[model samples]
Target: MKQRGFSRRSFLQLTAGALGASLLAACGSSEASQPTQTGSGGGGAQPTTASGSPAPAVITGVTLRVVGTGVTLLEPIREQAEKDLGIKLEYDVNDGPAAQQKAATQPQSWDLYDQWFNSVKIVWGSGNAAPIDINRIQEWDKISPMPKEGKLTPEAKEGDGDAPYRILYVQPDNTLGSIPTEQISMLPLTFNVDSFGYRSDLVDEEDVDSWAILFNPKYKGKIGLYSDPSTGLMDLALGAQAAGLATFQNIGNMTREEIDTIMEILIEQKRAGQFRAFWNSFDESVNLMASGEVVVESMWSPAVTALQVRDVPVVYASPKEGYRGWYGGMMLNKNASDKVLDACYEYLNWWLNGWAGAVVARQGYYFCIPENVKRHLSQADWDYWYDGKPAAEDLLDPFGSVVAKAGSVRDGGDLVTRVSNIAVWNSVMDEHQYLVTKWNEFLAS
Candidate 1:
């Protein structure tokens, strides 16, 4: 029997890659885009379940425009939501910088914004992060208190995932407060702790765990790096520090001096042909690895999984310096109408209905509500991805396609085990413009 709010058939049919994806289609796997994966619910009649039950309902005339990147995990679920709830999940996907610009200048372009937490600060600067009342979100109580309270462990602050105090709980006047309140900044979606990945078949496992391997002169010109300043900068910072070229007081919020030092090392590497290519999206990262042009690169988990599934032998490294983490989530547009606001709340609640979380787990992400998501997955599925157990059988993605072979074990172990060890979250520091400028120069150099 299917759950009432989400039918088994109406649930998402797509899977994910590790880390985040751009808001465009770029598949790293050999079968990145199969004809069978084409039932995306962009424009279709409300679908029916095997039992002939009516799909769930939303306000007939209303369509919630969701803005996000082109991540595949959301495809099946987005299709299912439009079919089951009978509302259009219109998307306006964009790359990292373009998406941030959209929030700053085009708040009304979309009713909901789905992006990373780091991007929220930029959106909030433009007054686009509408305060979402906790009362309206059905999952408010069920959300792990860690988000509101702001610390998963004594060392790791809420910044690693949800730092509610930073933006949550706005007053009627829209001024922010530090305490947890009835209103939240955004709905914490999915996140993961990540590090660079390499071709284990090429790089010895003993040389893979440390970040220094990225800057090793031996592999220079055969490495890939992220083009995005935030993620890519952290990777370089870790490499620079690990190689003893430079050390920072706080790499997350690097000072101008620290930035220059980091850039100098990275620029030196770039000029020396240390990097094969710079990737701006997850697909590019996967393609670079699959092409065998670059033997090592910073990567997303899904990319690693994608390569391994193809027998490419990629490994997502758990660096000795610690993981660079990120959280992707949803925020209401500040200028939406009451009707749109209500519809948006329904949509947020719908995510917590468990189906979306299950789809996310397949690609190596940890959902805000894992228990709710666990209900939709098999014991074997959960055991392999979440519990770090060996796959009892071939593990399938949300599309019911084999992603992991039998006897394969997850790389970093369980969700709790991975997230609790995060060293920093993706962030836009005080000197973002300077950092971006340096990043661009490094790429062009």
Candidate 2:
């Protein structure tokens, strides 16, 4: 069940992605309207200062409003950005669903959105979002081509052109949204992977090598599932692929029939009362595992770290099937002034090249600019995080025990394989609605 008192924070910190979504919606005020800036001819448009200077004092003495889902680790980074850029950053945090609802109803209230692929598609399809000007970004060329070149609908290929959104940030894998240019609509934020979290006190390590631990009847009423459909469904698909019922490529290109088959298996498991709880928030999932209410569940890297920090007797498994993952980036809002926009770029560049990536890595999550930050991290740091060994100190709690161990992708141990395959999962999701429906029915049953 969805946890009470778990407020959704903005997903993107530096970008004004998820602000004011809930307040106006609850108040029923339509005061905000989506803002669109006219694109300049040669370079991106520049906003004039009151003094008529070209740049507006380097974003000093200015406040930029950003919105998104919140992460505890990012609070310090937000403060650092404010100090470095000479700008004050105000944030509004909401979850993916709430953010999408607000963006749909009051587009102008939020400057940008840091959400999953489904939410991004909804905003783009509804004409609520503005297209980005990719030309002004300095490192635009560093972005991978999948997100930029992949949006070609046949009609879009004609005069319609690609969708107006520019990717300012991107996860290494383009599962959730496109990679953004320095001036793109979105920017890459952090790199994260998904794994099966289990109670070391209950399940033996050898017996839980595969995804089967989730469906094991012996653990009925002790399993947890994420409330979000996308992650759960992806887990099901990955589990099915691991069990030899399907291949990752097959799951990616799943037909309705294939989805139905997978869904049927999940429904059967659900009917058997396998799930202990369905978690809707990060805290809920972490708490459930920490308190021993759940023995196993699909989980992200950071949350597992959080639990370990609390001295929870849990371990993140490298299942035989492989881990699931996603990447995120920073995006610019069309409504942001040019000065604020430049400050956003400065923050993005510094984040990718500076200590920000290292800070993120310490929390057991990867940063998008892995290459640039390699020298900043130590060999032991690389082994524990990227190489998949457990680090001794818990960056999240500082008192938690080391939890993760290194493994291979084929043996369910690789992180890169998880993030790089999000697009494939998107395609698989399209064909797997029947399966999703079945899974939902199973949950209800």
Candidate 3:
């Protein structure tokens, strides 16, 4: 009755440790803490700017504890916020799901949150998420309509990152809903679609073009998977359809029966020694790719970038079955004190101002406000990242490290070309607890 004694809680307990990883797949510490101090600035909304107009008041002297993955704690963005906005940002960067769990269970653990848009059901379902007034965010109007309407350009309308038009915009009652209201449930940030990557030199380039390559018998024990219950499972679901092992009603929202089929196939593959190891951290993924232990694996964009920098000869694949996509945003904690609530609002506005978006975009993410971020970038960067042109010069990452060679090109091409191919969005699904348990079992097996 319960699908072969796979009790709901049995294996998913493996996720209690949950192998915390950033949404961007950047390397993060087990535990990291940073302090924000007041800088030389006046008491106005636009402290860093020369504008003397009094618009909205930003509170000073309180540290806003943000519970997020390491990508959300990008040092450049953090330092800029402290210097410009006159507010302190102290992030509790951990695994993505752990941040969700904390938001759900411990409502007051942090003042703000940085998470994937898919976690809305879990985070808001926990009733800890508070509404962010649309009026408070200065750049609200500046946000590209791509996030609200799921259209990167005027003609292409399916979506850029997952279901942006679906998950954003909170309802009047402070609940997550589709239609744009004066109050958005969360402030949309950066996102990108993802697919597996492999060592092009190791695998036949001709055979590496489909999701089926992940399950091909020839590469048995040569592949690895990220140990995330959500994205990993969705990728397996897509791979199943591609490999002719199974099908799903909706790969994005898999039913219990669909999940069982996926797990059964995974168990079969496990028995055949198809997997070498499961990656729990971005650094581990880099190690796996660089060392050539696992020739192909489910990979994040940033991980692929990291690998390419090491001269690993890795290429992120464009699967025929399409990509498993994901997006992220920041949310306000409902329990935040009024004293710090305004400060939180200021922080939210800062995210949309373009500096933060520019930082992550260097690692392959696209922001909701591309224009603002473009201001912080060169025409060469905009051309390479958006227009599909070759890089004009060696590209530097946010920290001034050369990550791209001169004349080099971004793999996924222009924004529209990449986002248009998304097959499914990452999701927690209806049976999160049960699937996590089953995932844990698969890992153990």
Worst 10 residues of 1 by lDDT: 31-40
Query: Which one wins on lDDT?
Result: 3
The sequence of per-residue lDDT tens digits that candidate 3 reaches over residues 1-445 is: 0111111233233223232222222232220011121222234333233111123354667788888887767777778777666678887887776677676667768988898877766566556777777776766766777667666676653522236556566654544446667766678888888899999899998877788888898889899887777788877777878889998877876777877889999998998899887888898889998998999999988789788877888888888777777778888888886758877876776666677777788877888877777777788877877777888988888878877777777777888888777788776565666677687678768
My TM-score estimates for the predictions, one after another, are 0.83, 0.67, 0.85
TM-score of 2: 0.67
**Candidate 1 ranges beyond 4 A from true positions:** 1-58, 153-165, 168-178
On TM-score, the candidate that comes out on top is 3
Q: lDDT of each structure?
A: 0.68, 0.51, 0.72
Determine which window of 10 residues in candidate 3 has minimal summed lDDT. Answer: 31-40
What is the descending lDDT order?
A: 3, 1, 2
Model 1 Cα lDDT, one tens digit per residue, 106-134:
77788888877776556655666677777
Q: Which candidate, 1 or 2, has the higher lDDT?
A: 1
